[model samples]
Target: MNSEPANRRIVRAPRGTTLTARSWQTEAPLRMLMNNLDPEVAERPEDLVVYGGRGRAARNWEAFDRIVATLTDMSDAETLLVQSGKPVGVLATHPDAPRVLIANSNLVGKWATQEVFDALERQGLMMFGQMTAGSWTYIGSQGIIGGTFETFVEAGRQHYGGDLSGRWLLTGGLGGMGGAQPLAGVMAGCSVLAVEMRPAAIARRIESGYLDREAADLDEALRLIDEAKASGTAISVGLLGNAAEVYEEILARGDLPDLVTDQTAAHDPLQGYVPAGWTIDEWESRRERDPAGVIAAAKVSMARQVRAMLAFKARGVPVFDYGNNIRQMARDAGVEEAFDFPGFIAAYVRPQFCRGRTQFRWIALSGEAEDIRVSSEALKGVVSDPTFTRWIEMASERIRFQGLPSRSYWMGLADRVAAGLALNRMVAEGVVSAPIVVTRDHISSGSVASPNRESEGMLDGSDPVADWPMLNAMSACSSGATWVSLHHGGGTGIGFSQHAGFACVADGSDAAAAKIARVLGNDSSVAVFRHADAGYPEAVETARAEGLRRPYAEALRG
Candidate 1:
């Protein structure tokens, strides 16, 4: 019996790079552990290289080193490339073949494991692993090719200039996808400008001591760029935000000098911003729907636009987009969905909430049942009577007929009802006990008011009011109970909310609660119900009155 852990398959490492025997197996075993991955062997075993020790830590480091060495070697290629993680390999292709570069962090292989690598490699292009030493590793017919940090810095220096006097602009600094691209340019001898809406985000940059204290927001960033341009500096501008809106706005401004944006779409919005040329760093290409639908949709749209814009690149216009290649590869492979939302959510959410005493159950409800149950005379006695029929009709119309800009705003409601009913059925069938039903209730007075005013008050709160019982119901509900709830106004009610029956913690209670509270105050209206105060039924009555009866009945049925 070989008696070795399956993780021990020889993976290719860069030539001239040191490696341990055990590192060779990491890719193989890691692939096996993942559900969708298949282990890919090197085309030629002799071309395969290994690094690191058999022991876990050494194996991990060696794997990283291999990626770094490969990327460093590839950066020497002719094409201007931007990569995620580390730029490991630059393709040296025939004149007819488009130049390709793989830029990613070495951590991609180590953490994403072999499954991701196999999936990426199956695209039939050269694969490179980004190295931690600020380099890249190219995996190919000849084996691992390497590059180094000095090379990347030199490339960046050559591209941006040595004095760091180039004009640079950045946006979306307030959100996760937003950050200091201009700062990178500044480090590369470009004058840095950043635009961010979130005060806290701006504060964070200031606190980090990264950006020039004077540059904040789009206008300020542009002013800095203009100032740098007057000083005879090379200019690079970056736009950041949600792809659609930010790009649209940047194009509308019409003032950008040498504009560059992280827009996934290739066609630069000609209305406001025109670029001398753009470069794209294809960050996320294949994303699964379900959990990651929103992000995937955005990326897909960006990729499509980028493909369309590639032609402009040949017109002597520099446009950066990564869609043409990825889309073609994806289409060839017939992969309908590439990104995994469930996997992402599970990876991100499960550890934080699942393991603790805090527990959550997915409850789905039938829209019809919810309407009938909440409107029943039995429940209406204590709870305010709502116009259930009207609300349902409106929701249905919005989903089916209205061309609302935000489909999620409408379809999500129906999804919530359906999911709640499904959950109710689960409870009724004993698949789960004490499941909580979540739904959306309307509290806004303008055109979308529920008939039950007081119930809405208790649930939605016209202004800022704290209902201890409602908070208790939510905490109790989160533990082990089927509670009826909805998405929108629940931000004001229970600490639980839903997007098409997919449950999420209330917005106020999201990971940044403390920071938000610090801004909103300890006694802010947005405070979510705490677990310590779990004992309220008044809110339950309000819920019951508002078509939450099916979930309540299902919960009580047991």
Candidate 2:
């Protein structure tokens, strides 16, 4: 082994005396071996070390033995090493030292058992493991998985501080699109100031019990906002109406902290409605031919609406545009008729009922057919007579100028009447082997006589006659070898409107019957059935037997 200089010889200290150079030198080799064997040993440059002279080998041997004995008597030592770099090697050495080392390890393998982790916890040691490469990877992987630094930075900012709760306001509570805005705002936890013009309409809304008790007009709404501001609540406002005066009034009040308007298409009446002749295919073709022109046209239209909305925005209000499917909206609004003929035909020929294919055939009387027709023609003669007027007038004062009825009431009534007439005509024409004529109690003029006795039936009883126009039209089709599938109408006891009827011809020969069956065969919101001839009770029974279904049962009950 190595030898030390005589001048550097270590002197032994007395028993229980503080450690001296000679004592440390004599005990150096044994202490070094013990430190090496001890897993808790520090690095060579940092930890204490000793050297011995050649003459002191015997003393060194004795000192080494004494040192080992002293160490055995002492308790295990604990040390805490805190460093910026990895202290894994230091930690591995002191496996049992109740020690802690803080560092980042990208791949933290299962190094410590449950017992060791518990021991570390007991010793109040916190080991923090953070990602080293600034990239996340599964074990045994090296490549990045679409890391975004900007997103990470933004996420960090949000986590530290981000305000989410802000006051919101919604305007307009009268027109279709505008009316729904306030309701939507209330659901989203925003304060709403519904500004409706018509007092009667507002009163109607109040009567309907849709609004809150505190809901009020513009003046009252402004008063509430003033009161809220006095109470120190931030108020944000949203406008939904097209009225420029109301928009200007809101701007002039100047109490709103934040204002937003849903004036998506305020400038033009045809803003969101597609022009009559444009189809999706044609639009796409035009888009390809002159993309810039198409864009400019769209921008011009949109810019006008935006400029109108910007009147409020210029007064420091924010605006929101709730856009919709323009083409679909136009079609629903009946503006599609203004389009080209092909487009108009496409819209008309589109399936009305989802499940069926029924072509509404328009028939006009010729010269001889018209000459033979009479205004007071009998119901049977009308069905058989081709001279009957093809165009039937179904008038409704309630129809809007927009060329659309308020609801489906008239259309549904017409369809039901047509079905009955077709069936009766088929039976008269011998197109069907069997024609079942079903009539409900409310529509039939016959007495409440049972079908069991034909002579007991009185043709001119209390019930109103069937809708003749629809019958006449169907009958014309039936006379041309088209079998009617079913016919139904009401009996004496009930009113005409309450009564329903249908006729069923044998299946094979009638194309109209096939179409009706195809249309009616699927699951639908509405169902038609053969009417009962006997009475109301019989009609109910017939309806039940036919398995007739209606989606809006509650609405129909009235």
Candidate 3:
């Protein structure tokens, strides 16, 4: 069986550097695992759901207990294997080997559909990983808020001459990853109107300080947004309604927002998105009893949403896909011009990828806010990138700690290595309180293959190739990452994506420092190498600038 979701409990991660396991390598993962299920961090911890359409941290309560027990008792020279979210075995490996290796939600290509996956889930044979969820790298909404904020700012720079004042962004979804949109939009100097289907999701975002206010209906939402737009003031308003319905309403009213995108779990129709007019209860009921019907209905709704989005695009508003595979679903559901607008990565974030820049994050093992504060300052000393410095300062002052005190910002390879080494040294020198575990979102430049997202619109037209993520995980293991994971159907839905996640523990020792250097450096090199092979001139130049020996990079660019 895949899981026993009925076994609900309160879970919290330990908040100190004291070893709960034999070493920091194992202990870090233990804390992160529990942190994924922390009441504040996860979306639905009682049901084992972390975020992104039922992505779970464990197969069940039983599996969680076993995994904790194994971590506590494991030797430094052994590695634990996890299948999906279930612990499968402990194998004899060297100390330099990853403390844990994981593979989640993978299926044969022909069988990678909602029907087959739902069957497997019902039979208890699989779990959805959804980027960082099952891989234990989730740091809550704070994890994505920085990237989201940056994306909005970039969009403004591209479309509005580096200013979003007096403009408003319209988007959907307010759970987990998507919840960051409201605050991020406000931070980017735009008013945001976020539509969320679930009532509780809206309330949660508000309580957690990610949202400014909730509107009783569409009129109030628009009024609030209009007030902000008139004054050129940054504000956010959450609307309690299905995005498809609300978007259609906005179109009917001819209220043209400056920019538009979406973040609904449209990648997983049956679980992630609700049909346009269906109540949550009816949607859930049909999802359980008639999965096929639910899929068909959701696709129809997705087509309608895409049609509305296309309408906005046709009217000259800057509209883009937010990488949830909604366009694919709409195209399959018979929307012919579904690809008219570009995805976010292609529209705004691909340049960063070209430089091997990623949303790199580090979590304090001590769970002390001071540890994160000190690390943030240390990171500034190491990277010196203006964006990094500004983001670190803003994050240090504005972000609220979720499960663990952590900080994230965009960094390229060399800066990542430098920061990793510096953080390791800090742990060793007691400049900070304890060790830090470094990780990144699996939706990265070189580690993900998703035609609608990370790898969309490649110069070489090789967006569907899945080999890069495998190589990424393999290299992470070989380069001494503390834990490495390979996942399927992350970001996009089943049969749509493959990616990897890795974590390196800097525990203040020489050995840990060496490992951190190798992993961070090698991982980014492979990342930029993928972009260079894709024929992006920026990637080729970055690769050459980094002194990577790629003899054919110039030829590929030419």
Candidate 4:
């Protein structure tokens, strides 16, 4: 801690039409980068840690300041080039080119291990990007709430034959991405028991209206879970304990849950997961002083947790990996049966990906809730998806704004374009107070190529192909995205994944409208094409119906 950066201070995004940059195109990324580190959003902003352990917005405070300064004075015709969170160069380009182009955490295959990454990081050469964090699109924990809720609802349809009312979901971890699980479970009409090692995380979720109850002991947490299930009520209970320890204890008790999954940060064992029987302080200290020991201890603990998950799977529980790379960690620790269960993406989210639907979000730069409301209401006009409408309504009522007021639309490309255009028109007409930034999670259908997560099990067994995301970044750049980022080793950790991110501002200009239509359509078009190329029939059908011109696909159809 003594060696960390000295710039430990509060940071917030500028609100209400303040022009810190030359234009909204430049200002959008600046505001989002600041928002990512907001005390209300970032998991540990003091150390530059945003979400996943050390998934920073910039390499250091110096890099952060430089990035902000670059964006502030940048011309619309110049594009800033960032490498692993450092602003490397600003080159002359056309106005339609991406204002910022970033490449983070990209290591050659031979040197992509966590050990090498840790060494380079200690020398201040690189930083982990972790999906949305480095790309500056994170919307706090609730950013993932809608996706998690839909996953639970889909799980209900698959196993329990449609409602999850009296059922209970047993899962672990409540940090960052996992923090959404508890509330998502309740919103899906189920009771949930989530085990987390941090007391502060539990309290934070409760304060954010994402968790309903908190317990310091396992027995008390179980009591709460039981009472909710018995009354057929939907509620979420966050229990303070190490996931590995609590999981083994639960396995000993032999009471099965309706669903099972995990979100512990097992991907970066040295800094992510907490080892069983270790105090949080010990874990933190050992992470810096004895990284090898921390990794070894976390891996051993992860094996224990995986064995318990396997037991639940053998007992017919709807168990799966929630994409934290826990199974991979356990496999490295000699747990061969660890991967008998499927990943959540392979089992649940792939069909949606095939249809070009994922997590799309828009943030009101004014930080006004009414601005978000006006935009979300515009979405209801484009499509009558009851699920979409219900989520929007519930989120409006229940979710609290973190840093910037935002709304998520889990919809297809056409609806996304229509909604975005409507918002742009509203901005022009003064229906909304300021510019809105439209973006999507890096885990979208066409954006990521992580075999352990997004592309877990492709139809053509092309899970390891990295071309899709590379093509995605190029497509977004060609389509005039405000910022286009290509990242390596984000979602599942070093050496395991690659992804892309794109976000553009809707500033109510003709240029902004052109970029939104092209980029948004390009986003879904590339997704359908990728899945169709992978031999998914749903993807093929969607491609044909959407009039996407793939010569081979059209030839095959004829």
The numbered model that scores best in TM-score is 4
Better of 2 and 3 by lDDT: 3
Q: How would you order the candidates by TM-score, starting with the best?
A: 4, 3, 1, 2
**TM-score per model over all chains:** 0.26, 0.22, 0.97, 0.98
Winner on TM-score (3 vs 4): 4
Residue by residue across 1-558, what tens digits does model 2's lDDT show? Answer: 113442333322122213321222112222222322121111111111111000011112233334334423332232222221112222232212222222211111243232343234235342211111100000000000001111112222333232112333534433322333433333233344554433443443333222332443467666665555466443323322223345456566765534344312221122121122344355456755755444345444333333434555465544433222222222333434311111111122112221111212111111111211221122223333231222121101211111000111112223434444554445446443322211111111111111211112212342233333134223322332111111111110101112112222222235434433432231111212112221234333434554555334325776
lDDT of 3 by residue, 192-274 (tens): 99999899999999888889999999999999988887876988999989888899999999999999999998998888899
- How many clashing pairs per prediction, in order? 76, 27, 2, 0
Clash pairs for candidate 4? none
Q: Return the lDDT, model 1, position 408.
A: 16
Residue-wise lDDT of candidate 4 within 361-431, one digit each (tens)? 99999888889888788777765566777788889888888999997868887777887788788888898
- TM-score, prediction 1: 0.26
Predictions in order: lDDT: 0.26, 0.27, 0.89, 0.88
Instruction: Score candidate 4 by TM-score against the native.
Output: 0.98
Please identify which of the two predictions, 1 or 4, would achieve the higher TM-score against the true structure.
Answer: 4
Off by over 4 Å in 3: 1-8, 551-558
Candidate 4 minimal-lDDT segment of 10 residues: 1-10
| Reference-based TM-score, model 3 | 0.97
